[model samples]
Target chain A: MILTVTLNPTLDKFYWVDHLPLSLERAEEEILIRARKSTASAGGKGINVSIFLACMGVETVAMGFLAGHTGQIILRDLLEKGVTANFVWIEGENRTNVTIIEKGREYHPVKIHEEGPRIPSHAQEIFLRKYRRMLKRAEYVVLAGAIPPGVPDTVYRELTQEAKEAGVKVVLHAGRRPLWEAVKVGPYFVKPDVREELMVGDMPVRTEGEIIAAGKRAVEYGCQACLISHHVTGDVLITPEGIWEYEAKVPLTKFKNLVGADDALVGGVLYRLARGDKLTEAVRFGMAAAVASAEVEPKMCLAPAAIEHEMRAVEVQFKEGL
Target chain B: MKARDLMRRDLTSVEPDTLIYEVVYLMEQSGLSTLPVVDEEGKLVGIITEHDLIHAALPEYFDMLHSISFLPNLNQIQKRLKEMAFRPVSEYMKEVTSVHLDDEDLHIADLLIRKRLKQIPVVDGEGHLVGVIRRIDILSRLIR
Candidate 1:
């Protein structure tokens, strides 16, 4: 079973608008208002990963710190969706993240963010203890997202060390200090977006070579392999065998949103890895999942069929000279 | 099964000009612990409940009045009587969280049970108050 830890889970609220202007007094016309509407769902980085894993018929557990009425709603929703959630209840109400989708505009389509709950120290410790216990049954442990407030950047790093000691393959998807700190513990895999790579390593990754080189450097720092995702260029994976690049596939239909693409990418990569797929195949699957997520509506990830279709079309090739 | 289905469609609400005693009497007659207060356009403005009236009737300084010499008993009794007579229903009314009639699809009864809310006001898309939902209405749904 795969164990996914979401430090700060939330209730996601999606608002669908047609031709939403930045600063507007009123909407003049209907502007081809489709049956487009908003929806609220349980969301967070690790939660999305677990949801996708469950959808793919994978055995996975979602653990996190949830609180109040909103937290209850999230838990209920997750249970209804068939995702096993082992949440540590906190004091404050769980935060609600809002995603605004503009269906008409292609360039500026969706805006996604979270006003995540504040987790106290005691709650953080409870989460860590629960995660430690979960690691005993988990084959792969995925640590995702930034540590909520009151949590140190070294929290994931500590968890990575503990998972390593327990002989579990740990995959970390985080940014900046947490990413930098987690790599030293020698996780099985690390996924960092282009921005995270640049911010953490201070490495200029303009081209594929720069990204691959950065991934190699992370491996050299003790990580088994690294997958760096490029926003417009796609994703690149660096392993002991060589470096492989899987260009992102654009779906035929227009993209409704790109909120959960990163988490989807992690889900895909972990799914393939859990199946014992090679590094290249895992990277390809990860890119396919990312594209599939971008194609779906906000807060609703693409089903397995969409990812499978995208995966079938994805092509990966090795580059020369390491 | 949406919030609109379980919401009270025909509601007798009060305007700002309605007397506090009259509002209390209405609650007593209707067997409601709380009532939704609306404006002339029938838009929900506030809410009045028994808890508010009880709080309003509490003496300002019962502690100090109890320490007075000869007239302590008389003063305390007089204060209690004044509080009961002058207490208004508006002072205790709570502000109901408004819900859009067309937007929400979940059953209002289920939401009330889940959120532990006593009452919820239903409003139109333009924010005009249309109806009110009471706990009894939700209970009746369960019974049926």
Candidate 2:
């Protein structure tokens, strides 16, 4: 069974409209009268990954900080969706992330990211203790996304180190400080976009070659594999066997949202890896999942069919000179 | 057994001024028998139950018609039903009640049962509604 750790989970709300006019009062009637679409789903990087894992018929447990009414909603939604959630109850209200789409127009899409509830020290301690107990049963532990304010960046690093010592493969999907700190403990896999890598290393990745080179450097820094995802260019996979570059083949389609693409990639990669696929195959599947995710409407969990179609079209080519 | 141990953590509450129809929908959606009414400041003010709703569904002249009724008049029934369907929750809800939190002692249950209350609002120290502890919550704990 896979164990996904989301330090900060959220209730994601998506409000969809054909087009959002610049002026509020003038456009209010039209936006409301037109085909208005609104949906609320349980979200957060780890939870999204667990949901996809469940979709793929894998047993997964989502553990994290949850609180208030929204927290109950998250737990209820997870149970209804068949994903087991073991979260530590905190004091404040769970944060909400809203995605406002102007349908096909890129200029009008508004994404409001809220900082999640504060986790008191006692709750944080309880979470660490509970997570350690749960890690005993997990084959793969995924520490994902932004750590809420009160949580130390070293938390993920601590979890990664413990999981490795306990013989559980740790897959980390995070940005900047947490990602940088977790890598020091030698996680099984680290997935970060080019921007995150540049921020952590204080160096820009100007091209595909530089990105691939940077990924290789990440492995040298202690991660078993570094998977670098580039929005337009595709993904670069660096492992002990060598470097493999997978170029995304699917054409850019109408995108609904890009909120959970990284989570989709983590799910895709973990799904294949846990099933015994080689590094190259896992990276290919992961990239396909992400590209497939980016093409769907906002807040839509990546459908398995979308992943399958993208996987069939994905083409990976090896560059010369190891 | 304390109220905290058996109170339903997942509660569906409504504002004191919410429309009765919306409360009915919320009741159906949440599968709850009663709803706690709260003020904007999160203080519990009242509670509404299904029985109160049924009473609110009766004709204004229901008492007058009782002397002659083999069957109530259709117009009166229709008017009563419409009123019941649209009345605000505040109009029908029972105001003022004993409320306790999970951390409170089991003696709170004894006091509530002796007072003939079906339910009590489980509130935090600040008086915000957190959940509701019914007679069943206590009964279940006793059985356990």
Candidate 3:
């Protein structure tokens, strides 16, 4: 079973307008267009992973710290979607990440990320104890997203060590300090988006070669395999043997939202791994899921049929002498 | 109309491993003849009703092997009643008759009528328990 750790969870609210009211002097001066509440669901990297895994019939459990009414709603929704949840309750309300999407211009969506509840040091200890207990039974322990306040960056490093000691495979997905710290734990898989410049081992990763170098560097840090996802140029899989790059075969379709495709890619690959797929097949499967998810709405995940279609278009080549 | 539009969100269900004594307490308190059983993920896996309880509580019917006499063993029956109260409901709950919230109106209506069920648990797209719809909820709408 897959266990996802969402250190900080949020209640996401989406407000769609024809155009955001840039300025309003009075009620009459307000930009008048029909506004609607699109959707509000559980929001967190680990929570999304759990939801996607549950959607694909995987037995996934999501653990984290949540609080107040927002936490209650997130818990209820996650349970209703068939994902088991064991969340520690805190005193403050969870955060909300509001996205103001323009109807015709979702490409440039405005995101408002609130600073989540400030967790106490005692709560950190409680969560750590819970995570250790969960790691005993978890086969794949995913350390997801950013660490919240009062939780040190070393949290992932320590948990990674605990998971490694328990013989549970670890998949690390984070950026900057947290990612760098956990790199010393030798995770099974590390996904760094190559589209963004991720400084892995003091190297600024930009091009395909740099991305491969970054993956290789992660492998030096004790990662078994590393997956580098490119935004438009496609994705790459780096291992000791060779570097396999995948060019997406996505058909032309008006993408509803491509914002969460990276997260979907992680969920899809983990889903395949949980089912005992080989490393290569898992990467290919993940690429298919990523492309398929980008082709449709974020709510609709990549299904097998779409995966098949996307697979036909994806060309994976193992480049030698890299 | 969709099943979710009319389904009651306040659910009263139990886990598969809940003790029979607690099951009896919950059922009696809720006044429900049939109760849905869910897993840790809250997926509707089975249902335990008064009938299942009766089947366990009273040894009216027996699958007991190689009985010389047709007479009911009062001692054995009493022993079963006593032991069943502490046993887990996983062995008793029946896994049948669950509807998805997005199920077609005709299909859910037919399933309910044909099965002679008062209500059934409503599952979401992922087959997790969401709510329940009773016959009275439909009846009230039809009459109105």
Candidate 4:
């Protein structure tokens, strides 16, 4: 089974408003806009990857800390989505992230984030122990997203390092600090978005050339493959074997929800890798997954057959020096 | 040399939810006296040994019968063994005394001598299981 870690998983609550029933003029008006509906999903970087992985027919086990009622919902949602959970239970409740939106003019969508439970030293120890056991069972591990408070930034580095030492392949798509630390562990794959690259690598990315250079620098730092992705400019892959780029299809239509597209790419690539697909094939699969995800809102994950159809329009170019 | 230099990196462990019959099967297959019980994270929770299996296999009244010098009933013991097979290893796993990764060889030797330990689970400073130091590993290396 594939292993994914989401240290600070959250219960995301999305509230939709039909209209803003408020008076703009200086007049006494009853201000009330009832929420048309509210929906919740298991939200976290690792959880997102695991959900897509499971949807794509890969056996996946998502590991992390879950606490209280919100945590139980995360667990239940994962089960309902056919993703196996191996969460470590904690005392504090899992965090709840609320997003309120009104129509397409959601210019100021209100978002409330809760601080997750603090994982004590003993619990951290327990999690590390659990991770070790999981390594033996998992062929590929995905370390992603924000870590809860009390977890050292270097923890991701340690885990990736240990996993590499144990000869298991690892894929990391985390935030700045953990990504920065874990990149030095020489994982098989590292996917850092353009903004995140600047945030952690402390490198300026003014142009595509700068982004590609940063990815190359990350490769030099230790990762075998570094994928620097940007929505508009496209993705640059830096690998020792070769450097390549894949631009989004021209005449790109407006995106519905780009939130999970990156995760889909990560999961898509890993799915192929787990199934022993070559790197080039895996990259194409990932691009297809991203395109499929970007075109729609949070819906069904692109199956391999659907990805194959999506890949028809994708264009991959091999990039030499400059 | 410290335990890290001698400890074997090929650690074999089972989770707390592992079944008793499976543990017995693994132990019987590998000829190991015990298997360390680890949680989902590689932290050491407990250890299940052959003795624990034997203890659980016998009827509860065996302790009471031992002082009275009774032969006791053999069929009842067999029935108890069947019942115990369905239980999890966590039910009977013995609490383990582990050594840290940087522990001196002398300390490990002392523990082995006093506790009569055949293998010592080596944990790092953060309490993650790093490796296991077996008596035979030390003996073989010293002889080499």
lDDT of each: 0.71, 0.74, 0.75, 0.76
> Candidate 3, after superposition: displacement of residue A239 in Å?
1.4
Any residue pairs clashing in model 4, and if so which?
A129-B41, A129-B42, A129-B43, A130-B40, A130-B41, A130-B42, A131-B41
Model 3 alpha-carbon drift over 4 Å, by segment: A21-37, A193-198, A251-253, A300-302, B1-144
DockQ for the candidate 2 complex?
A: 0.02
lDDT of 1 by residue, B41-92 (tens): 5467787766666555446564566534545356664565465554544555
Lowest summed-lDDT stretch of 10 residues in model 1 chain A? A26-35
DockQ of 3: 0.03
Off by over 4 Å in 2: A22-35, A106-108, A193-198, A298-302, A320-322, B1-144
Error of 3 at A285 (Å): 1.4
Using lDDT as the measure, the top candidate is 4
DockQ, all models: 0.02, 0.02, 0.03, 0.07
Instruction: List residue ranges in candidate 1 displaced over 4 A.
Output: A24-35, A110-112, A194-198, A251-253, A298-302, B1-144
lDDT of 4 by residue, B75-118 (tens): 76577778888788889898898999789888988888799888
The true-versus-predicted C-alpha distance at residue B22 of model 4, in Å, is 24
Clash count for candidate 1 is 3
lDDT of 3 at A137: 61
Pairs that collide in candidate 1 are B47-B93, B48-B93, B52-B92
The 10-residue segment with the lowest total lDDT in model 4 chain A: A250-259
Q: Per-residue lDDT for A1-322 in model 2, tens only? A: 8999988888998877776665667644553424387778788888998988887888788888777788878877876676766666666778898877776763235788889987788667656766776676689999988789888878888999889887999998888778878887789898864433554354456667676776777777778888776555377777766777778765555445666777888899999988999878887888778777777765434577778788876788776434
